[model samples]
Target: MIDRRHFLQSAAALGAAAFVPLALAQPYPSRPVRIIVPASPGTAVDITTRFVAEALSRSLKTPVVVDNRAGAGGLIGTDAVAKVAGDGYTLLFAGVPHLTTRWFTDNPVTFDPVKDFVPIARVSSSALGIVVKAESPHKTLGDLIAAMKRKPGEITFSSGGAGSTSHLCSVMLNDLTRTRARHIPYKGNGPAVTDVIAGQVDFTCQGAPSVVPMIKAGKLRGLAVTSAGRWGEIPDVPTTAQAGVADYLVASWIGALAPVSTPAPVVERLSEELVRIAQSPEFKAFCASQSMYVDIADRRQFLGQLPKEDAHWKRIAQLSKES
Candidate 1:
């Protein structure tokens, strides 16, 4: 029913309407982006998150700053990010602790870790090592395990806190070996390692970087690392499998995440930039220097793997409760 002129006008209007959304939409990362690190400064999470932020600042063409929100085992900052707008302005630099936080805390978590955040990219990870005081009578992992088997709950282990990766490492070890060890939760990794050095506890499954120096200084002895293979820094140390228990690998990983329901376009942009940063040579060099590795997972893989990891931790929590 339309005339030629009317038809032409309608076509032009349709073209303009299609262009409007694209023109009005602000380009992603128009402003500074904040990375919320839910741990104290100088912690592994904080250090790696800062590296990722610096690299993102370069690639995103905007200032990417790290905001350390240390409390509740990284729950405070992580919860803040979860509750914020999903505009990609705020993000969380999450670690393994983020997964087990709910299990550790007495208060209900304010946000669902899996459902409340969009996985962006994995940053870096380190291997945990079993370390005892240099003067401990046990010389090898087998000797320690034999003693644990003989004593069962008598062999005590310290961790950064309950439900930390360090604690979980010992749990996984115990689970594999079918042995029980007493858990002594400390305020932080530093104190836990300090106590171990003083022989206040038996041993600790702590990150290599935290205990490597002590190992080098003859303060602590490295028995086994929790990686599939020997870590570069301590090549002399055997892996958990090589040490005794086979098929045991528990890596301490950190990654990036944004609030759930973030725009797909923004999430894509952030994920792309972060993956690039994680894979860059500069970052790899930094990780190597720190005895870490660039373990990257893209958005799809990260999200897909979350459910499995969540379930795994949940089972561990349930088992811990049962025992």
Candidate 2:
């Protein structure tokens, strides 16, 4: 009984209603994004994340910010991101420490390290160097190993903390080389490396970026690099394999992650942008200035390798306890 005009108008209204959802569903990054660094500002993790955040802002045409949530050895900040909505707004700028945190902590962590997050991309990694005081008699890695063997648990090695990358590096070396060296835990990398320079500690397995300057200044001796290849900055120093400890390589790396259940499309977009940023010349230059190297991997590569790294660190942690 309705007139043609009235019937046509009602049909048009239903059509508009059907189109509303499609129009309202905007693409990702409709607003600002935040990359959370679970470490203090000025630390390596913070610096790396800030660089990526700036790059992402340019690529995504959105305002990307870095949020420093430093506390409780990065647990507080990491947990914050882990528990947030899977909306692609919050991300974690994490490195080796993040993977090792739960293994070392006594309290139960709130999220599953392997299941609670989606890998975006691996940013970069800094190689660990085997270093000793310039005046130390142990001139080579072999000499240091021999000393540790001769006096098991007598020679001391310093690390940033109990479960830091430095600590696990030393522990892994001990396990593979079948030597025993006492571990001395310090508050941070700066203090631990400082004591090594002061000859307070026998040696330390620390990141090359932090120790390269000391080596250049003749304050510390670079024996070997714990990387597959010789570090470019210290090309003369042999790799762990070349120095006789076969199959030894370790790097402190940073990667980006979104909360699990974040849409696959969102994850893909983030991964694409991150891969671009990591491969950019600007990022390489920044890494060189910081004594680090650029090692980028896409989402699939990162996700595939994460489980192996987790197992590797777990074994290192167990070795630490035995040592």
Q: Which candidate is the best by lDDT?
A: 2
Candidate 2, residues 168-264: lDDT per residue as tens digits? 9999889989999999988668889999999899999988657888898889999999888777777888999999999898889889988998888
lDDT, candidate 1, 178-284, per-residue tens: 98899998877899999989999999998866888888898999999888878777789898888888988887788989989899888888888888888889999
List candidate 2 stretches off by more than 4 Å. 1-24
In model 1, which regions exceed 4 Å deviation? 1-24
Q: Give the TM-score of candidate 1.
A: 0.90
TM-score of each: 0.90, 0.88
lDDT of model 2 at position 73: 64
lDDT of each: 0.86, 0.87
Cα error, candidate 2, residue 227 (Å): 1.3
lDDT of 1: 0.86
- Candidate 1's displacement at residue 263, Å, is 0.9
